[model samples]
Target: MDLSIINQIRSAFENLPDYRKPGNNLKYAVEDAALSAFAVFFTQSPSFLDYQQRMQKLHNRNNAQSIFGVHQIPSTSQIGNLLDPIAPETLFPVLAEMGDRLYTQGYLEPFISIGDTLLVALDGTDSFSSEKISCPCCTQQTLKNGPTLYRHTLVTPVIVAPGQSRVLPLPPEFVRVQDGVDKQDCELAAAKRWLTTWGAHYAPRGITVLGDDLYCHQPFCEAVRAQHMDFLLVCKPDSHALLYEWVTDFERTGEVQTIEKSRWNGKQRMTERYRYLNQVPLRNSDDALMVNWCEVTILNAKQQVVYRNAWASSHTLDEHNVVEIVAAGRARWKIENENNNVLKNHGYHFEHNFAHGKQHLSNFLATLNLLAFLAHTSLEWLDEAYHAVQTAAPSRRTFFENLRTLLQFIPFDHWQHLMQFMLYGENLLPRKT
Candidate 1:
């Protein structure tokens, strides 16, 4: 564990007012719970309770005092209870600021690319859903037998690029249907809400939001445009009948630019065909939304078609940037394959049964997990100690395995102490020999 990183995080926490004061008095002052929760994430722990116990044992064994000013460690139940009453306003903004810090500090550049075009992929994911457990913020639905069920939240991350291993998670807005709203909230609705909330923050950076076909709708496009942002939304033939009809007509006339190419990778040969429509109307209205559309078809050495996809974007069309735009649009899958999949199926066990409290616990835990992932990713990208370990290990799994084994036996005074031990030998004191 690196004390510098821990100090950075502690400073961020200290910036927020102590909830125990007169107005919002901090009933709990155990910052160790927050710190341990983050640490346990990287250890692949199943829950925060496990993290708390591990931290306590480590501290007691090492006779460790406070890492910073945070001396006390609360029980897992107290941590959950403390988090339950926390307002979203108090916690989420700090997380968002962390993302911004990572960006400004250059720790996030590897994951977030800035080139001729900046692409941001957005998608909503459910953090928790249950039939038995219920909370005030949970979205409820009636069962066929008339019993009610509840869901926790749908989080949307403003991902920078696809296939890039790292993702800077934005502060998510939880979606819960109102009591008398009489509407079922979906991903698109949540996306719209996200746009309204955090869209302005990224506007100066000029991002091109990428989404699936569901986001190609008229209203969604309008929302993106209203935010002064661009979009590259998937355009499926089944859904965009009118738009496809126009494309078909244009292709028949040979008016669209079509490029056919082929390549060989060792024993495998691949062929691709690309088509582009520089300017096409998204809808059939008098003031139609004009967009640039492109498609790519790929065939393997066997001449078997391997992949095919199409997309539309609000960006103005240019012959030079068409392929780049299409590539960025295609990279949207990375959010699912890299970020979401890694969190869910990888050692993180993102879907594991963590405590589900009455208030913001679930979301808070999820956010902490994401922050941990971000921290790990940052170390992999930036920290020399992490890089050395990764190079020495057989694979990422092996590296983490060694890390977990080390954590079980060693008691770290701070995160930096752990990192120092990993980089140099455990006997190498911070002071000179």
Candidate 2:
């Protein structure tokens, strides 16, 4: 933690009054909430009260009030009560602003390529949904034996080129039942809303959105085109029966192109085959959209084929950029492996039960934890001093372990002072001057 960065974050919090000013003489400010949320990631605790208790013991000698910047730190019940009443709208913007700041401060530039096109991947994940912990946003179901209930959210991230290490998250939209309405919410509907809202903001920058086979429908493609954005959505044989039928019809007329090649990888040989269809209509309707389709196959030296896939894109592919588009489309898996998987299975424990307030507590805490991750990722990607400390350590895990250990034992007036000590490997007290 760098005090300078913490100060900058504090300054950002100053502008968000909803997080701070709820009533007269409220002890804790928004900064405390933000800090408590951040602490959950490193500690992997189940509740904000537990996080506060840990922080107080580690840094404030059990004096939670002093550590949390109030006359007294709010109890776990207080935190839950406070969070349940607040709206999710207030916190999401702050997280988005932090992301913007990370970009403006040059932390994200290295991961992004200097090109006219950017790849934004859209995916849906169930972050908070439980039959027991039901909220207004929970989706209900009816079982053959009884009633049913659940919740879900659609997560969209602005990723750079494929295989890149960073993927910045956009605000998520929870899918819940509508009052007096009888339609069950789906990911496609959520995605449509996401695009209409945030997607419009980035369409002018020439973004290409990527998604799974479910997004290759005519309506979805038309919606994306309406937003002035392109798409590279997966197209499976089973789902695109009409398109495959058309391809089969066209192939009989010799209207398809195929390329095959072989290469050696030291111990083994590999083969790759590419099949393409250009300027094909996506549907049979009179105003059907045109798209490009490509399929890839790979075989190993054992004479066994190892990989197969297909994709459909709004971008017209020629010899010059077909490979690039395919690569970008294939890279959508990174969001699953690097972002979602890391948050859940790795140290972040994103699925771990934190607090689920009646209102926005769970969502707000989730937003804060994500912001901390983004901040940490930016530091890893951009900050020279922070990078130096990691470079000296054996690995990133080791670096974080040591960093946490130091935070537990040492008390500093600010975050930068702690960073300075870590970088220099010296005991330096907060400056009196």
Candidate 3:
């Protein structure tokens, strides 16, 4: 609602622990370096700070200082050097704050579904990869021939709902080699870390974690329940032998439950079959965890099977709630389509290597990029002015392109003025005397 959101983020950067000793090169504070990097991501322009710096020299003021609270604009290299050592977790508080603001403003009501539970989709993605350029934090793999592959991967968790386009992401966990650990990091390990760290914080939101078949194992499901959360993870028959074996046995006696519903597809009627089995063993062990299994199959007007899928859930499957549970499980794809795809392919340039520092630069920049996305999402959710302008624009890329072009030529004294000028072409500059 207010530009104080920007200030709050600036404060988080300002409070970062400065590893550099006192010297003349301290012309720019750590906050300036961090905020400067964020401004580039926020504007979706690589030379945003360069343009602002030129504006500062010509007009004696720049949007970087006025809107983002940057005192001195730092060079791109300086930004990388300054932020490399700072842990990405330093910005986790800002992410939590963003979610709280949205919730407090009553914007999070639509995200709540499946009987008071918020669906959180978990998935991993590579942020940086290079066969030659490598860092100590990089995870490596040997190829078939000779060359090794080095990459940085992180687990992304976002709040999603069925038929919802918007997704709110939580702080990511990097999959990398730890100090005392011997084995290479993995998605499941990073996911377990994320659960251990933030699960309690989000537990009050009534979260139901969702993931692919990789997370349907016994240990991970137990971890989810241990945090007082629920899960509806994709379970494949091939990977889950014992579970499906039990399911096959249940089918012999017709112990499995089935419900078929008919709905018109605007052209003709179609049938959707829901099959479920409760209290099924998840694995072959004697102490295996028991979970509910459900499947959904859709047939077209010609009675041809068009789609089918199954899942394992912590909640019991029943005739009344099975449909809702299946829908929530299907929404997990939003993380891949709406969040990850948008960030990587859309304007965010998520996979683009902005900076690859020796220590933590790649992941740190990724975090700042995520925060920029969160900032824009918050503005769209809360600020009517921003929403109107963005909606009026032809596309997201065109919207940022207009902003960058205007900022290169015009200097606004306030963020609201920029939005107003873009919306109605109202010149808010002070009158000449």
Identify the leading candidate in terms of TM-score: 3
Instruction: Go through the candidates in order and give the C-alpha RMSD of each one to the true structure.
Output: 3.7, 4.1, 2.4
lDDT of 3 by residue, 52-147 (tens): 989988999998888788889988888988899998989989988898888878898998888699999999999999889889889998989999
What tens-digit string does per-residue lDDT give for candidate 2 at 217-288?
899998898999888999898987778887788889888777777888797889887778887777777887
How well does candidate 2 match the true structure in TM-score terms?
0.85
Instruction: Rank the candidate models, highest TM-score first.
Output: 3, 1, 2
C-alpha displacement of 55 in model 3, angstroms? Answer: 1.6
Instruction: Tell how far residue 86 is off in model 1, in angstroms.
Output: 1.2
TM-score of 1: 0.86
Choose 1 or 3, whichever is better by TM-score: 3
State the lDDT at 233 in candidate 2. Answer: 91
TM-scores for all candidates: the values are 0.86, 0.85, 0.96
Model 3, residue 175: distance off in Å is 0.6
Off by over 4 Å in 1: 1-4, 15-30, 46-70, 105-115, 141-149, 178-180, 424-433
lDDT of each: 0.70, 0.67, 0.90
Q: Which residue ranges in model 2 land beyond 4 Å of their true spot?
A: 2-8, 15-25, 42-72, 102-115, 141-149, 178-181, 424-433
